[model samples]
Target chain A: MNDIVLNVSNIGKHFGGLQALENVNLQIEAGKTHAIIGPNGAGKSTLLNVCVGRIKPDTGSVKFLGDNLTGRKPHEINQLGVARVFQTPEIFPELTLLRNVMVPAFAKREGAFKLNAFRKVDNEAEVRDEAEHILEDVGLKEQMNGLAGSLSRGDKRRLELAMCLIQHPKLLLLDEPTAGMSRHDTNRTIDLLRLIKERGMTKVIIEHDMHVVFSLADHISVLAQGQIIVEGSPDMVRGNARVQEAYLGGAHV
Target chain B: MAQLWHRNDLLLMGVFTLAVLAMPLWLAPFGAGYPDLLQKLAIYGIFAIGFNILFGLTGYLSFGHAAFLGVGSYAAVWSFKLFTMNVLPAVLFGTLLAGVFAALIGFISLRRSGIYFSILTLAFAQMSYNLAYSVLTPITNGETGLQLTQSDPRIIDRLYVEATSGLPSTELFGLKMSGYPGFYFCAAILIIAFFFSVRIFNSPFGVKLLAIKSNQTRMGYTGYNTRPYLLVAFVISGMYAGLAGSLLAVTDPLAGAERMQWTASGEVVLMTILGGAGTLIGPLLGAGLIKYFENVFSAYNEAVLHQIFAMLPDWLQSAMVFVVNPFVGEGWHLTLGALFVLIVIFLPGGIMEGIRRLSSLVRRIIARSRRDGLQAA
Candidate 1:
């Protein structure tokens, strides 16, 4: 409990008459990869959204490093070191890849607001080099100068990861990061995630891919119908009758 | 690489300065080389360029920017009435007041985005226009507009001049601003504004704006409180409009409520989109084109057309005048509208896109010719 980086307690949300999330409690410890697995329309994304302050829970709260984030704006929560990667890669398509990486770096350094209008972008030598370096780590250095909109699906995800890495964020929330990757690209992403895991930055990955959940998650939570039905280590979750029911129904279990 | 970027920026600024300064000579053939028309070109050029910073970079689409321009001119005239007849105080006060107004309006309007934001700005600008025309007649001087008065207690002017019988125009140092001198004055400010815009386009703050336009969600999640950035851009652009408005008064010495009408605000929009929204020089080109149509083309009539066709036979001359009847003089708007439609259809990026395509085609032709020449050698 003391080492928990994120604590979502009694979170509940509803859209119109439909329940999107219901009483979901999740705890992510520092320096660990926590994976939440669920079938389609299982409220996994809603849970992540609540944690990142994108959704105001009808009931309950989220705390990040002992700071309340429930009522804060998304950007304010991000300034406190929580970065979210969207289910779809949300990137500045009009800007160059290096600029995309550099934008976040500026926000992280300058905070919520700074009228640094006079300083030339190219003259921010330190930030530029760091952006290039991160692109190198992600194997995107070769395309740093190209527009980000032109990147392949796999490369866009990598670029998103590089964007987060530059922020040096305390907690990274990833929504379906490998949702549409091929097997080769998926494995490459898994290796890349493993490389990041060594740096001890906490991550909460909402995924549908069982292989990815089994490979990297130190802890796993299985969500069903807007509730966390089962949770444990990968081995325990793999064997659990409830998780199998949640994933493939009663017949599969 | 940094040095190269700076050099390129410098080269652009240099070319822009030269082109603007040489307008008088080049525009002479088109019959727009006179001081009044040249000054209008420089003035509106500043207005469009400033509007581009907001609508172009951030994609905010402020429909009330003309309010800032109008506010600037009003403030400049007031400055001339109260403080000094000098151009410095008027320009500074005009720009500063417009910036202040922008911050206040942007704070409210930026709360929404897209069409909603545009509506909010439009509503605000219309309110200002109505208020200036009807409610705040005392300040705006209403239909007659804010004008310099013979009895105005201009502190600096009072200190310098002992005899004040005739109405005096705005001045810089001892150089009277009329005719060619006024055009030069406006041209100087336009150049400075262009340089400022070039710097902004290359700044980190500028990139943040583009990111906002591209993906506001990503920018917010990336830890930027986007409101501040938006507000800054709004104020800066507003300041630019104000400076332009002030230049208008500095040359001609009047600020009218007509300048704040919604149509005026819409004109700046047309200029930006017609020229090229995001490019550095596009707005200026758009402004020049629109202003030329409004001034020069609007002056032509049946007599002018007949004069142009005089060399032809009598029937042919009559035919030419009849054919050209609706596109000039009072029908200038038709000509501008047709041009706008054509530009939008053929060159979605406006005139800048056309220029780019033309240049690339030229380059390809040259490259092919050089290849053939090398093979022959």
Candidate 2:
């Protein structure tokens, strides 16, 4: 078996009376894509949030590369080689695409924070080149000088992905990499993921599209009402009776 | 060598140095070449530049920065009284004390952001002002202010020479810190402060601050602890205010409770906004313009206005005076307010943005004319 990059066990979260997540356990292996597929309220996002340290899970613990990630800050987790792509791209709208990617590079190079107030930002030519290379990899070299906010929804997603990939994260958590894209854009995103996967990077993708899930995921976990009903390979998850009754019955997937 | 000179920061520093050094010559035309107003310009320029490091870059509008200025003034005055009449010690002590005060206020105020942060600073400033006026009277000398006296022990100066004057004015070594010398000293400090600001604006630390301004949540997720950055900026700005305050004492040798007033804080905000907050040169321009209006424009009364309009017809002169009456003299603030409103409405980016727009428009016109000339040829 491949080494587990992330081990989230018995995680439970509550928002007042509502149970956002209940007894969730996920083991994301190294060099593989794990897709968490569910209905609208299946708590996929909540789990992703917990894993990234956005929300504190009430019970259980998250261990990434033998370090306890529970109750840590989002930035702390990010510094520990866990980069996240949000549901909607959260980029510096006023800054250029190159700068949008450079911020993460600076963070990765300078640790969480540093006081390099006297040195010129442009003097760090290596980081700038790395940012440019990543922007080129994501096919945003043409728009690298343009404002991140001016990009189309598809381009914004691509820019955000470039930001994460530049960090060279050991584990990437993507919350719907192609949520509001057309079929063409979605196919392009799938190809991007395939390219990333070829480099042996671990990814935990929370996606709604069954086509994306089946195409990208090496292993699939079917979550329904904040609990995973079945977890296995794509064929096993497709053949699971409980998953069919709970989620896939209504959808044509 | 050309590349070194061509760098943005070096070029800015060179321009600023030339302007400040030649202040006496250029400002003579504006009738503001006198030492007092020139020193005021430099001091307030430092204050606004410091304030911009936080407010302009991070978008943290501090409403209580005057507290630091007041603290700095008081500290400098005390330094004069106890230690020596040297301007250096006074300035140093004042800046350090203001930094400490800023750290204290910033630590508590930064917990809450946006308007809440602003209100917290305002409250703290008001508290400082009231305390300086009342309960802290023993230290602050109440409304009368802290002033140097003849009887005060001059431990450092006494080592060099006997008491020659009744009241020793502030000095740097043997050189008196009044008149042109004082203005030059303040100008030198202002240039240094401007250079530091330019460096901070171009540094990675500056980019982090801008990122924090753009999206704090994204910065946090990007693994940056933004609170420390904010606090550092706050303290640095406060130190700048303190330095300005120290210069005020160095030139005048008095620390007053009124220096800590909210209106004084508001003036710096006006300076930053009027000149263009984020740009390096904006705050200095704002400070000079406001000071010029306050000092020179307010001195223009009905006699001066009538004299200027003497060439015009009698009816036109009276009409002009009537129209301009509310904007000059005692009504100078009315003019400032109107200008502020107009800038906000038409040029939201402030004077720097106005300059940028005008320059771009000129460039466009020039480019079109060149194309037309080429076609004719």
- Please give, for every candidate in the order listed, the TM-score of chain B alone compared with the true chain B: 0.97, 0.97
lDDT of 2 by residue, A183-205 (tens): 99899889989999999999999
Best by lDDT: 2
For candidate 2, list the clashing residue pairs, or say none.
none
The per-residue C-alpha lDDT of model 1 at residue A187 equals 91
**Candidate 1 lDDT, tens digit per residue, B122-179?**
9999999999999999999999999988888888777877636888877888788898
Question: What are the per-candidate TM-scores when only chain A is compared?
Answer: 0.96, 0.97
Q: Provide the overall lDDT of each model, using Cα atoms, as 2-decimal numbers.
A: 0.91, 0.91
Once model 2 is optimally superposed onto the true structure by TM-score, how far is the C-alpha of residue B187 displaced, in angstroms?
Answer: 1.0
lDDT of 2 by residue, B1-377 (tens): 32563486577788889999899999999899899999999999999999999999999999999999999999999999888898999999999999999999999999989999999999999999999999999999998998888877868777877887688888998799989999999999998999899889888899888889988998888888889999999999999999999989999989999999999999999999999988888988998899988998799899999999999999999999999887899999998998999998999888999999999999999999999999999
TM-score of each: 0.97, 0.97
The residue-level lDDT of candidate 1 at B155 comes to 80
Per DockQ, the best of the predicted structures is 1
Off by over 4 Å in 2: A249-252, B1-6
Instruction: Supply the DockQ value of model 2.
Output: 0.66
